[model samples]
Target: MSVIFGLAAAVAVVAALGVVVAQRTLYSALALVANMVALAVLFLTLDAQFLAAVQIIVYAGAVMVLFVFIIALLSPGAQERLHPLEARVLIGGLAAVAFTVVVARLTLNGVSVAASGRFYGRLGPFAPVLVDRHGQVQTLGEQLFTTFLLPFELSSLLLLVAAVGAVYLSRRRRAS
Candidate 1:
């Protein structure tokens, strides 16, 4: 099951990536939606049902709609290649290096808390009142709501900033 799921995820990622590379903005947005859906599925397979649902609801549903809307509104048209070949090569090399570093971190270190033993083995393997007591959202929520509520609320304020920035950017500028 794991092997099959992993292979499916790999295919989804590759297909979405190819779509992103394709010239059509609409197709690229759809491809991003596909990638997000695949990620949600992957989350479900890892027993993060809440996260999976939230991912689909928030990112795949809301975010993708926003992306498509923005693409339509902005209408960034296809343009002739502007960058010189050398600049493209330099950027490609930088991107490759970044990708290599990310893959190495994922493969060797593993990003999850379990692999890192974050919480420093405090979160037990199993406990009631949580999913296998994996201590992900539930624990994080507990800590945030109880101990770190202020910071959590503050984080939501960042969303307001994002909204303001979006309005400012989308609104037409007036002549001085």
Candidate 2:
């Protein structure tokens, strides 16, 4: 399990670097997708199965798709290499390495799966909300709908605001 975690962490670090270092925008976006997937695996390694699925579904699947689509639509020549080995590139590389080291250390030292209060793995919670395969999903839904409802609604509202702002900016630019 530790070996798998290490490999996934390595992949995640490389992918994260690729996100910043790739010359082409599309390549960077693809790297970002890879990074997100590697992160999901890392989450799974920690027995955070629900978090892993959400990471893959939300960030890797939805967010990256939107990002890639927008890039493809907005910039025809986005594949062209813009910067090669600028000073910021070196700085970014150093920062990434530092960040990876910090995260790895924290994950290895601070996180403990067995210490989690909830019943994990094949164990049974058998609570009223759920009893089987959909236990995690049901718990997540309950939390989202009950405990975190305000934050969820706010996030949706935030997206709506962003969309409206984009349209307004585009129209304003066109009118100018």
Candidate 3:
């Protein structure tokens, strides 16, 4: 399990970098799909089967397919290559390294604190009881519909707007 988790983590990191650094938009979108798949593997390793499935089905499947289709519709030209020693590249690399270090330190500290029973975070209301009774997926569905329905509907609305905008832009490009 640990080995699988480690491998997935490594793949996730590499794929995330690929998403940022890939030259082509299509390649970046593919990399994002890889990253999402790796994240699903990590979630699976953590025993969150529903989350893992959603990660793959919703993110890797639906979102990535949309991104790829957009890239295709846009027909973007090749990105200009930056020099290896460019100031922007150097600064970005340094920032990424610093961010990674800070995240790693925080994660390690959080794990140690939790393991030592020193982390006293607020507990969710009725989480355990709901999970015990209805299971994770059912509990999540209930909460999503009842508690988070507005936000969920708003997000769907936002996605619809984005899709409409994409189609409008693509049509405008073709018309020009």
Q: Which candidate has the highest TM-score of all?
A: 3
- Superior by lDDT: candidate 1 or candidate 3: 3
Query: Which consecutive 10 residues in model 1 have the weakest lDDT in total?
Result: 119-128
State the displacement of the C-alpha of residue 107, model 2, in Å, after optimal TM-score superposition: 5.2
Show the lowest summed lDDT stretch of 10 residues, model 3: 121-130
Question: Each candidate's TM vs. the true structure?
Answer: 0.69, 0.62, 0.71
Per TM-score, what order, best first? 3, 1, 2
Collision count of model 1: 0
Q: What RMSD, rounded to one decimal, does every model reach?
A: 4.7, 5.8, 3.7
Q: Report, for all candidates in order, the number of backbone clashes.
A: 0, 0, 0
Model 1 clashing residue pairs (backbone): none
For model 2, where is the 10-residue window of minimal lDDT? Answer: 123-132
Provide the overall lDDT of each model, using Cα atoms, as 2-decimal numbers: 0.74, 0.81, 0.87
Please give the lDDT score for candidate 2: 0.81
Q: Can you write out model 2's per-residue Cα lDDT over 1-176, one digit (the tens) per residue? A: 99999999999999988987777788889999999999999988866678899899999899999999988778556645556588887887799799989989877654565467454457334343453456766777777888789999999999999999999999999998
What would the TM-score be for candidate 1 when compared with the true structure?
Answer: 0.69
| lDDT by residue (tens digit), candidate 3, 1-176 | 98999999999999998988888888989999999999999988876789999889988898789889989898576566668999998999999899999999999998998799864677563455557777888878888899899999999999999999999999999998
lDDT of 3: 0.87
